[model samples]
Target: MSAGDDGLVPDLGRGALTDRVRATVLGRRTPRAWFLALGLATLVSLLFLLGVVYVLSVGVGAFGLNIPVAWGFPIINTIWWIGIAHAGTLISAVLWLTRQDWRASISRSAEAMAMFAIVLAGSYPLLHLGRPWLAYYLLPYPNLMDLWPQWRSPLVWDFFAIASYLLFTASFLYLSLLPDLASLRDGARRRFQQLFYGVLALGWRNSARHWARYEQAHRVLAVIAAPIVVSVTGTISLDLAVSIVPGFHFTIFPPYFVAGALYSGFATVAIIAIILRGLFGFRDLITRAHLNRLGIMMLCFVLVVDYAYLQEIFTAFYTGEAFYRGVYFDRWTGPYAPYYWGMILCNVVLAQGLWFRRLRESVPGLLSLAVIADIGMWLERFQIVITSTHKDYMPSAWDTVRPTAWDWLTYAGSIGVFFVLLLLFIRLMPSVSMHDMRALLHRRREGGHG
Candidate 1:
């Protein structure tokens, strides 16, 4: 649906993606703003490289973890990053499969985040390994050591789960990009930009026939990716649930992890949107209306988390199970009480404010919530990782895992890395999916309700 499809109001509900997509991809506008985005993103990328070097040279031991708290920063970071990773394809592919047109603008960032988040997250499991080089042992291979990977282990499951997600996310990101790349290829004025996008376009002509086939294939891929994101993280949740651990071993783990993933993922998206809008001056694209839509979704996610947290506590203490009760007590009335309370305040108290219509729509308020929610989600993951391990069945093995400099730096560097990659994605690529947005807007112009 082009802008001319409908004689009536066109592109009204089409969202920011369609409004500015043509200018972005065709290089119709000036490049001064993009140059600035490139410079900032480059600086952040350099910092990320330095961080990786330090992490590799120093070894995983430089982070935190003793016998009981063996899974600390790396694991926690993995969960948080992976959670943030889910929203990309989850919203893009999943929602697209369900025919949610409002998701158009957010899908590009969502898909990109899935790629980088997995890249960043996939590193931690290897980094935390005793012999990082020997990490491939998790893969299932016959004729290898007589000792096969324990199918019962979550760590082993995570290897396949994350790997599958990374592949699917990469494929999904590329598929969505091809059309836009074609638009850039056909429209770019500069020789270098033409050459760059031309390769990605793969000799495509942006004919109506091509767009039709591409859109159909894209819809199919989204259908595949949506469930993959949900299932992948659910498997991760089982890594904790199937265990003998009290706070963990339950059917709720699947939904709990899924909800947490959305909670963290949407928050990360909001943070990215805020940055992209600020740096790129694409307030026309990543507008307040779009932010409001996502903010509301985030608001809902937090509520789901809060509800889940309550049920978790209720089941633990109310069930009369000694193990669950003990875990609950250890977290609530124990040394980790401060962190637990912080989680409650941040995740619950702040979330309740979204009940008011104004707060969800406010820029400053939504921005603050997005940043705070990220911190809250990180702590929530920490609560899951630390609380469970800190008060395990064996009291002798229980100990607090305080982070070292390496842990903090590595995590800090990842923050820089996400922004670094995101900033570049904004400059070099369309942060918003232009082709899809254009179609949706075109349909809207034609008076299509969707």
Candidate 2:
């Protein structure tokens, strides 16, 4: 209560603020365990190379496609991966805008995943081109003959969506990274590391003026990123919505894609969080409170998506459209009925159980459920892509397109490659947002003592 205590408060604040909190590139002790982890990840990446070789040598038919279903797994997998990336920007950008303190610990990794997964997803389009080379024809250029993209096409819309979203996410990630880069620049024992971090720090001296600008730039980027992410998913839906296919065409496609995006994105977040928490032993920072909050988000999206599902059926039956009803019935009662029902059970019913406290509180339990939800969401995208492609207004055009062993191999390998990248990131980089996290800890301590 005295003036003396007030003066000492600033001293205490500065003392509690440690450099260890901000820098995550490496700690005091480097371990043998880290290298072993990297070696294992390198092996997983090689498996992905095998899939790449198979796809390249055998052709697109290796994955199995007949006529109308020419697009197949490529488009669906692209959207699914991109959708799974949405939560990164959502957590970092939108939560930052709302001043959510929880973001301090989670945002860095979330943004990292967003950038990496987006890059991963972007590769599929080139693979789908089959030639893989000369795929740049899709891009617009000023030539003597007047070369330009077909702006009227949804595929064109997808190109723009992925490109813009990736750029925006990169900017957002780098902007957040500047302060941390400065910490590394200051702490470096090596000249090359110093030079690398120094340039990125942009001569940041951490003055009060610089701090103000840092906060402002982060907020402005978040404001822009939130809508860009939503639009990206919406454009994916447009690819299906613009189609005349009975199963694929619907007014609900945009919202449906967005919901599916959130669902899978959160699952991706959950699995990543579980691994990071265990590997880094960051139990205090990324606590059960965060898990519960994420669970709630996952549940909300599933319900919204389930509602969309109901409406799709209602519109079909309610309008008495013969083709719509027949397709709807065929989708549910058809050979793929197992997949449809499984999606409902895993995405909807299983996610709803997160309402129970014990389930959210359990680590292994929650991760298992998160994996289930991710699988269910993938099935949702697959159902949308394949079923609709095969069947449409014209019944004669319809034929089942079965996935070959190569199709299954590529899907599984993509997931392995994703984890391999994530494990390396956790080891090489700071897994938590040290600056933001310290800011939060200081605030909490101040509030508690007062």
For model 2, which pairs clash? none
The sequence of per-residue lDDT tens digits that candidate 1 reaches over residues 1-450 is: 455232212234544444455455555554676567656656656655675676678765677788777888888888889888988877887777777666776778878877899888888888888568888688777855586899878878889999998888888888888988887776677898889999989987877788788878887887788778788888888878888876777778788888888888998888777766775566655667777778878888888888899899888888897878899888888877888888888899987766666776677888888877888888888888888987778877767777776677678877767766766676678787877777766666666653
**Per-residue lDDT of 200-231 in model 2, one digit per residue for the tens?**
78998988899898888877897898787689
Ten-residue region with minimum lDDT total, candidate 1: 3-12
Off by over 4 Å in 2: 1-24, 28-40, 190-192, 447-450
Count backbone overlaps in model 2: 0
In Å, residue 153's CA in model 2 sits off its true spot by 0.8
CA deviation > 4 Å runs, candidate 1: 1-55, 142-147, 448-450
Per-prediction TM-score to the true structure, in the order listed: 0.90, 0.91
What C-alpha lDDT does candidate 2 achieve relative to the native structure?
0.77
Question: Which has the greatest TM-score?
Answer: 2
State the displacement of the C-alpha of residue 401, model 2, in Å, after optimal TM-score superposition.
1.3
